[model samples]
Target: MEMLCEIHPLHEWRGLLSQLVKMAFSIFSIIGTLPIVIVFGLYFIITINSYLKTKNLSTIFFSLSFLATTLTYTVWGLRVFLLPQYDPHISNLLPYWTSAYLFASLSLIFLDFACIELSGIENKRIKQIIYSIILITYSILVAILFIGFEVEITTFMDVSDLSISNIFVYAYFILLLLFYLTLPNIVFINYIRTSILKTSLTYKKVRTIEMGLSLFTIGTILDGARFPSNIGILIARILIMIGGLIMLIGFTFKPRAKED
Candidate 1:
């Protein structure tokens, strides 16, 4: 006996839409990171030249941060293209973890820059302590993820699948939501309230960075949505890329010499 299984029209339409969304996201991801790489590459080169001439440690830090961010986006864009169609293997963990680490590092770098560059925190000891705490906390999370966690890729509503569960994964998202999303907004609001330089162009640049952070935060939240629709994911990716662009623009404006 031959059994013929007839697919429902609604299911077929949904599957087509899902595929289309995934294709769109993948294409955008590929195209979006190209400019980021070029811009950051130039930034890194210029920073290196300036550092060589002046030997400013801050300049070196800024250059390294930009380099890391550029690599993060590049790897992320590549991963979108390389994502497995089926369940991911244990071997796939390395690339996934590497991309995540790079992204998290980028966030930490920006936070450090905000504290030192924008907030004008001057106590070296205090800065060291804060940096150590952040690094150690993230390191622990990464260690746990590397050692104890297992990733499973499962399809939702016949769309492309992703890792949906894991304690360390949840912790990473919570940390990002708190630090990258919430803290930046708080910092910006505090600056607006207390800053004497609010009328200056420098302050406006800081505000632009804040806006970029807000966009990135929203995109992160959208990316984490439990909805089965792949459109949300596509939109989230686009928002993230735009946020990156805005952030880069903000970074281009150096703080006034008198302010520094």
Candidate 2:
């Protein structure tokens, strides 16, 4: 006996239409995000140019990270749309894409933290060594995640497929959440609370950085909830968008010295 597979026309049509809509949204979202990414890219480059003139290694690293993030995400979104067919090779892209943005975010945090420590800490070399160790450790972990990791992606309207390495990726983020999100925040927050300053631009910059980090943390939590809670994701996206806009505005109004 031959077994017959029956296809429901309405169900098939709905699935096709849902996929089409998702593709359209992906395209539009990428387009919308590009200008903001470019603006940040330009600011980062300009900051790096200035840093290069001054031999400031810190800013140079931060700028490079941001550039990497811009390039990686741009490629990521395009790759997904162009090759909508699910393939195992697509999973390999996760590590590089994840590392780029993670590095970028950390670089910015380092720049700010380094700046704060410059005023308070007497041993500059020690600070450098500590930061180097932290970065190296983070790099090694991301490398581990790149080879085989669990990832979840929604192909149709409500269904998602989980890749093989979910536990590892989750563990990786837990480390990141502790080191990058929690520890630095507490250190910086304490530094801000105790430090005394008289209208220094550095103080203002630190405050801005803190606010930016807070928003990113909130946004990450919201993103994590997207699968189980779409409404939460929407709220989180809005918070992140606002935070990004604020950071962009700060760059535009960055302090400049008066002509002599």
Best by TM-score: 1
lDDT of 2 by residue, 1-260 (tens): 12223446667888888776665465434444455467556756776776777665545644564465455445545544554334345455455446544554564455445444533555779677767867776677657655655565543212222333477666666566456556545655766787787356655655665676578567755554443554454556556556545544433346668411
Predicted structure with the largest lDDT when compared to the true one: 1
User: Which residue pairs does candidate 2 place in steric collision?
Assistant: 149-165, 150-165, 150-166
lDDT by residue for model 1 (6-65), tens: 456667889877765674465445455566667667766776676788775655665676
**lDDT comparing candidate 1 with the true structure:** 0.61
Residue 214 alpha-carbon offset, candidate 1, angstroms? 2.0
Residue range with the least summed lDDT across 10 consecutive positions in model 1:
155-164
TM-score of each: 0.66, 0.65
lDDT at 86, model 1: 35
Total clashes for model 2? 3
Off by over 4 Å in 2: 1-36, 52-55, 85-120, 149-169, 224-231, 248-260
